[model samples]
Target: MKRTIPLAIVLTMGITMMVQFFVPHPVSVGYYDLTTRWIRIVGAFALVLGTGSFIMFHSDKVRRRRQGWYYSIISLVALVVTTVIGLGWGIRPGSILQNVIYANFLVPLNASMFAILAFYMASAAYRAFRARTKEAALLLIAAFIVMLGMVPIGASIWGKLPELAEWVLSVPNMAAKRAIIFGVALGGIATSLKVILGIERGWLGGGKQ
Candidate 1:
């Protein structure tokens, strides 16, 4: 009964949401709005549940004095401090949470993370641009044209290089992008159907159907 009730709810909600896309009736719109509000309420409860799980998991690690337990302690401290600041001070524009914590701490941390990611991206690009095969050679040439076209030096070397790059981007790149999007859309539809029909039981615990 436990699994059956949840599965039924999921099936009903999934089919209703999908059908609502094709439905233009006032009733359908009302239902959509009602469900969305309920979703937000559920989301608040989920957030609380998630926080509890996080604290418990980290606390266990810290209690065991496991490897890198200091990191877990730091995480727990950060969570508590951030939560208290946000709740107590209010996250208004001039509040300490916004001005000090967000602007001074979070913003710089995010920027640093992104800066590190840029190096990884450059490394990946270098490996991808290596021309060993015919496909790789073509990709390298296209990438070269695109990169050079964005610069003034390319126009000085060849005036038509920018136009050629634009063609490669608009025509071949866009076509491939659309094809990939279509494939993704189809895959999502298939997955949704599997879940709705109870064919996908992975979401159920213990790998049981």
Candidate 2:
């Protein structure tokens, strides 16, 4: 009975939403609009619930003095400080939260994180581009051409390198991208249908309905 009621509501709403997409009647459109508005209200409550859970989880860690508990304290402090600042000053342009916390702190932190990520990406690329096999050699050559073509040195070395790079990108790269997108779309549809039909009950929390 605990999960049954929620599952029933989900099934009804899912079918209604799917039907509304195909049937453009006034009633269907109005129901969709009303449901969306209700969704926003529900989302607000969910946010509050999530925040409570986050605080409780960190608070337990801090109380237990677990390994790396200091990081949890920092997380909690940051959350509270940001929440207070946002609520007190508002996050508008030129506000203290925007100019001080965001511009001065967050922007540089994000840039530094991305800089570190670039090194990791380069390391991965170096390993992947090793020309041990024929396929690996082909990939390495394509990657080399693409990278070099973006710079002035490639044009200086060979006049047609840029055009060759453009063809590789527009032809093979785009074809692969479209194939992946089609696969993803079909998978999404299958997953959605499973959820709508209640075949996917993992959302109910326990293993296998």
Give the winner by lDDT.
1
lDDT value, residue 129 of candidate 2:
54
Q: Supply the TM-score for candidate 1.
A: 0.89
User: How close is each model in CA RMSD to the real structure?
Assistant: 2.2, 2.2
Top candidate (TM-score): 2
Worst 10 residues of 1 by lDDT: 200-209
- True-vs-predicted CA distance for residue 139, candidate 2, Å: 1.4
- Provide the lowest-lDDT 10-residue window in model 2: 200-209
**Backbone clashes, each candidate:** 0, 0
Each prediction's Cα lDDT score? 0.91, 0.91
Give a tens-digit lDDT track for model 1, residues 89-186. Answer: 99778998999999999999989988898888899886765788999888889889999987888899899988988999999999999999999999
Residue 4 shift from truth in candidate 1, angstroms:
0.6
What candidate 2 gets wrong by more than 4 Å, as runs, is: 125-128, 207-209
Model 1 per-residue lDDT at 143: 83
Evaluated at residue 1, the lDDT of candidate 2 is: 72
